[model samples]
Target: MGSVTELKAADGFKLAAYRAAPAGASKGGLVVIQEIFGVNHHIRSVADRFAALGYTALAPALFDRAERGIDIGYDEASVQRGIKLRAAIKLEDTLLDVAAAVGALKGAGKIAVVGYCWGGSLAFLSATRLPGLACTVGYYGGMIAAHAQEKPKVPVLLHFGEHDHGIPMTDVEKVRAARPEVQIFTYNAGHGFSCDERASFDKASHEQALARTLDFFGKHLKP
Candidate 1:
């Protein structure tokens, strides 16, 4: 249902991406951002899932700028490695990669971004910085509060885990206060609650959040 593709960013950097197309006409295009774990099996599955829902989905390898072919598991060592790779790349570069993905889906109708973990923060930044996006969704982004003051050019929806130690309620409140127009939801779970591969995965929270996300996309990404 998915295959590897290449995208050239604004800087002319070629990066690998996982592209998934729906069986029939596409409802819209979705740029699925990767968590710190890179465009591994989980991210590919995410893109395939969206494709099954009638959306042409693409997940770019943002870490390709640092090192090509980065796919790791959900372990502490992998986390540290992912962090190091993320640090090596700049935010601006990541957004460029995201823009390239949006460009790749030009004829798929309206485009939206959906991200998790570190990609979640990138999703918020994409809404604030990039153009041509219909809407954006972020799940458990830890760096959003620091940039909450920055205005988004499109509608934004955010989800957070109430028990996420990395992102406190204060941060969520700050985002809510700064961007009152953005829809925000909190669950009674811990960090990475939406990820089935994580110990903190919460089935109920993940399902509820996914439903809301799909609804939000449905309303905003209309053809």
Candidate 2:
């Protein structure tokens, strides 16, 4: 249990992060990426949860580049602003921040990454482009639809809602086809089902996805 902080990425960009470490935590490192709403309480709590699991977890604020400390609710206007901020930043630059976070956890054993929504897409890219990560987990990344062709080079896990309107089954299947080596699962939920702050949060789906994610990290990112 600790406080939030900031770290410089590989490209000299400053990104905020929340780090949590548990007692006797020697399990591997996991970087919990944030959603479009920024690294708010939800994301920080996620880091704490991971720490309790006996793994060092860090959640980097990717939105720090576009707008530092931007935490908004899921209202219509907030969603629009979140989308705008998400789109304003380039994918490559975001990956660089992920790389820097990974570096910070270097020599701490194998590393894994878990991301949600927009961060989910970046998580996939992080596993593909960044070095040193043993595994990657992405949840309901709608933007990954456009980049399915960029297959992940590392062991990856993906979770999606079968009823997600923004990300259809066809797109999910395309991503599956593009990267058959990665594990993919579909649930009977909607977009942002993993986030409790969203209207679409589904507890069953969230629990199932978390179990699968932990299992995936256990297999590939075991320290």
The 0-to-1 C-alpha lDDT of every candidate, in the order given, reads 0.95, 0.86
Give the poorly placed runs of model 1, Cα more than 4 Å off: none
> CA RMSD for every model?
0.6, 1.2
- Candidate 1, which ten residues in sequence have the lowest lDDT sum? 190-199
Q: Candidate 2's residue-wise lDDT over 1-223, tens digit each? A: 6577778987788878888886785589888998888888788888889888888888888888899888778889988998899889988888888888898887667998899988888888887788888989999988776887776778988999999989999999989888888789999999999988778999999999999998888899755
- Considering every candidate listed, which one attains the maximal lDDT? 1
lDDT at position 61, candidate 1: 97
**What TM-score does structure 1 among the candidates reach?**
0.99
Q: How many residue pairs clash (N, CA or C atoms closer than 3 angstroms) in each of the candidate models, in the order given? A: 0, 0
The 10-residue segment with the lowest total lDDT in model 2: 144-153
